[model samples]
Target: MKRWWATVPEIAEDVRDALAAGDDIHAIRMLMDGINALPAAQKAGTLDDALNAPDTTGDPRWDALLAGALRYRLHQIGEHAPSWTFKEPLEKGWWPFAYSPSDAYNDMAHTPAELMRLGIFLDEREFTQA
Candidate 1:
């Protein structure tokens, strides 16, 4: 299933670069802008698609990032509880949700390259701009 983040590679790269530069705020802002810039129909459809897609990818990192991105997006829309106050069921032995536990820990674990890969994977490759 295509995800909202998967549809915007350039924006994802920008966010990853910002994260590498130790500017998480900028990364989050870029993410927010990218989502907001999408047409309303696309945004709604993509969000639903991502949420309903089965967790076929067994990689914990991918799972964590995908879940985090979804949560972050929800937070932006004022749908998620305050400060990302939600706990997803854990796959036994998997690291706790990256964003939770602690901000510092989340940053340490989710490196720029990891985020870049997640972004690339999420991109649906359905449309191109020229």
Candidate 2:
């Protein structure tokens, strides 16, 4: 029989709490695991949830980057960005997880155009961008 499930907002909430506590790594873990657990979720729906998730950690950079990265993914799949995406400003710094300068460069070389514009360099794309 097929499994039953809905959107995974729990993952977003978990990420929000983790980020609020300054535990971004844990937040990314939650994001990756959630996507892995529900890999077949409608891509558009998942991206929509991401765009609206992450309510605010009082950190504009993070808030906006998350929205932009998710929105970038939506654009990649040919979906329209939710109107609220413009509310997120383009952050100026690389996201908090950058391990080194070279890593950031490598990431930037491959980051999609929209995310680059939003300034989400050096992301954990394998999962967080999923």
> How well is each residue in 38-114 modelled by candidate 2, as lDDT tens digits?
43445334444433444564557655655565556556556676676664445365655658887777787776665
Give the range of the ten consecutive residues with the poorest summed lDDT in model 2: 1-10
TM-score of every model?
A: 0.33, 0.65
Which lDDT tens digits does candidate 1 get at residues 1-130?
Answer: 3343533444555666766687755655665555454444244665443234322223444344444454554554555422322334433323322445574355444433323333322221111210
What is the C-alpha local distance difference test score of each model?
0.42, 0.57
Error in Å for residue 38 of model 1: 1.4
Positional deviation of residue 73's Cα in model 1 after best superposition, in angstroms:
6.3
Q: Alpha carbon lDDT of residue 126, candidate 1?
A: 11
lDDT of 1: 0.42
